[model samples]
Target: MILITGAAGYIGSITSYHFLKNNYKVIGIDNISTGNARALEVLNKFDNFKFYEGNFGNLELLEQIVTNNKIDFVVHFAANTSVFESTQNPLKYHDNNVSNMINLLKICEKYDINNFIFSSSAATYGEPKTNELITEDTPKNPINPYGLTKLIGEYILNDLSNAKKEFNFIALRYFNVAGASLIAPLGQFSKSSLLIKIAAECAANKRDKMYLYGNDYNTPDGTCVRDYIHVDDLAIAHIEALKYLKNQKTSQAFNVGYSKGTSVKEVIDIMKKISGNDFKVEMADRRTGDPSSLVASNKKITSLTDWKYSNDNLELICKSAYEWELKI
Candidate 1:
């Protein structure tokens, strides 16, 4: 069985479904913090699935699951992701992102489970000025607590692997993870993520205005550019990564993205067209630690396994998000 932390979260929930469909038994853990209970309701439909409502940081709860479930591998996806929030409370990021990750590593050690996968972020590399694409080896100079903490978490996982020598891990450094779950029946919810939520708000008329976080970025439109990979593609990557690790493929880290970018205003404009609502838009000062552009070099992931992206350019991404907004 595979143990998935943060299983009620956007990416983790989708990954759970993929594993279930691929005929793997999955045990999921979430504290209901930053997780949608509705997502868990949809996931419970599978017979091969078991859900544990608990935090991975709680060693007692985590130990119980690891002992009772016979967990064969772990795919960790729990962390504070907001750049703004992390800046405000560095302690929250450290306790959850860094401390919880180390605790998970320790649990793996105690449980004798050697294989693991992680949901890392492009935030691991802060504000790229000129690199059109970021590779796994890109120089990391995280400018915020959130980014620095994720980078540190990656190092901890890698260090654990080196120290154990028998344990193997695959850390997927994800760019912006967006889009609804493409498979029928499990659509995106309002709480799925930022981009999707923004489109949903515009679609629902809940938001009369949308704020573009920054407009002074050094890009064509002076807005932040991000890779914005669809959630389904990311789920597929996780399954493939699991299989690759099962086959003992030894790569430790790989960037997961389309290597394409969509600007901030460009996304809002697309949403406006799709939702038929010209919501107010404001260009504000640059958000702290936000990179001008963060596109991943996805070649390593593709070459290593059969993983390939299959959805949503800028306009399409926004359109699908709007559609899901109406549906969910």
Candidate 2:
């Protein structure tokens, strides 16, 4: 059986559906903290999908699952991802992202279960030295605590591999993972008011417009530029990476995003057009740890897994998110 951590999370939940549709016997684990129980409701319907509602930091619980289920492949999407929040409460991110990963890796060592697929972030790239797309070989100079933790996680995985842990793994450094689970009526069901969610709410009258964090950046649009990839495309990348690792390939990291980025103004304008509600978008000061631009050199993942991004454009991604928000 294949195990997925944080299976009820936006990315995890969608990847779970993808694996199920592909006929993989899937088992999921989550504490249901930031994850959505509503999304889990749909996953629970599948016979192959079993869930253990708990944290991976619980060593004994993870050990039991590894021992009992004979988990062959593990897709880890259970990291603390909020940049602003991580800065406010750094310890929480360290504990969940770093400590939990160590615990899970220990279990993998004991059980001799090695294949792993990790959900990483573009934050690891930090404020890029240049506007060039980030490749796997780029120097990692993380600027925030969250990004530092991600870099540390990658190091830990590399260390384990160096010690001949016999584990095969891949870390997909995601840009902005935006979209819903396309398999279901509701796709991405996040608890927090993320950018897309906030925009959708503003359009739907659930909220009064939205906040454009900063505008006087160095970019042409004078706003942050970020590469947003669809969740299903990311899920497919994970599956391909899993398949490649099963062939006994070495552990590696790849930038998982389109080689392009969209400005903040672009996103807001698109939301306004789609929702037909011009936002009284107030231009506010820059939020903490946010860089002006970050896009991926998606070459590694594309070459490694014969996979291509289905929708890299911002309009389609925003539209999908808006559509999903309307339903859920």
Candidate 3:
């Protein structure tokens, strides 16, 4: 069985559903702080799925779960993810993202659960000197507390792997993860400030207008450029990472993206075309840790793992998110 932390959140819930559909028994834990109850309910429908509602950092809870269930692999997703919020409250991010991760790693080591899948982010790259597609070897200079915490997690994993010959991990550094599940009622239910989600809300008439954080960046359209990957495609990347770890006892980090860059204006245009609604978009100053451009060179993941991109189209991504937004 596999243990999934933050299994009620957007990406975590969807990934857990994928694993369950593939006939894998999943044990999920979530504190419901940022996770959606509806997503948890959907996962509860599966017979192979079991859930524990608590903080993943609670050592007593983790100890009970680990002792009771014979978990083989761990997929960690629970952490603070907001860049702007992290800037204001850095200690919370460090406590939740960094310290809690350390606790989880300790439990994993104690139980001898050697295989791990970490939910890292491209924010760890910060603003690169050149606007080139980022590779795994790129310098990690995080500009925000959120990214720093994730980078520190990667460092801990790397150090642990070097020290322990039996332990291995795969850190899938995600790009701009957007869109909802193509399947019904399994999308992002929690409120978010993500661009696509906000655009979808405007299309659904849930929001009067959406704010574009910055439009004077050093990009083609003076807007930030990001690599948008569908949530389902990213979920597949995790499964493929697990398979790779099972086959080879080596630790690696792969970029999970389509190696393409879409500007903020382009994304809004696509969302407008797909949703048939030209929602009002107001410009504002750049957020604290906003990067001008962050496109991924997904060559590493594509070449090394069995993962492939199926929903790489921008229109499909916006449409899927719009449809789900209409429901919630």
Best by TM-score: 3
For model 3, the superposed segments whose C-alpha errors exceed 4 Å read none
Residue 149 in model 1: lDDT: 90
- Model 3 lDDT per residue over 43-98, tens place: 99999999999999999999999999999999999998999999999999999999
* Backbone clashes counted, model 2: 3
Clashing pairs in 2: 180-187, 180-188, 181-187
lDDT of 2 by residue, 1-328 (tens): 7999999988888888888988999989999887889888988888889999899779989978977797999899988888988888999999999998999988888888888888888888889889888888888888788998998988888888888657778888988888665556447666454677678767767766578888899899899998888888888888888888987578989888889888888888898898788867887788998988998898877787777767766777778887877787
Q: Rank the candidates by TM-score, best first.
A: 3, 2, 1
Better of 2 and 3 by lDDT: 3
Comparison by lDDT, 1 against 2, better one? 2
Candidate 1 C-alpha lDDT tens digits along 76-190: 9988888888998999999999888888888899988888998888988887756568988888889899888988988887888888877888989899887677783454553
lDDT of 2 at 328: 75
Please report, as a residue range, the 10-residue window in candidate 3 with the lowest summed lDDT: 182-191
lDDT of 2: 0.84
Better of 1 and 3 by TM-score: 3
Separately for all candidates shown, the number of backbone clashes (residues 3 or more apart, or on different chains) is: 0, 3, 0
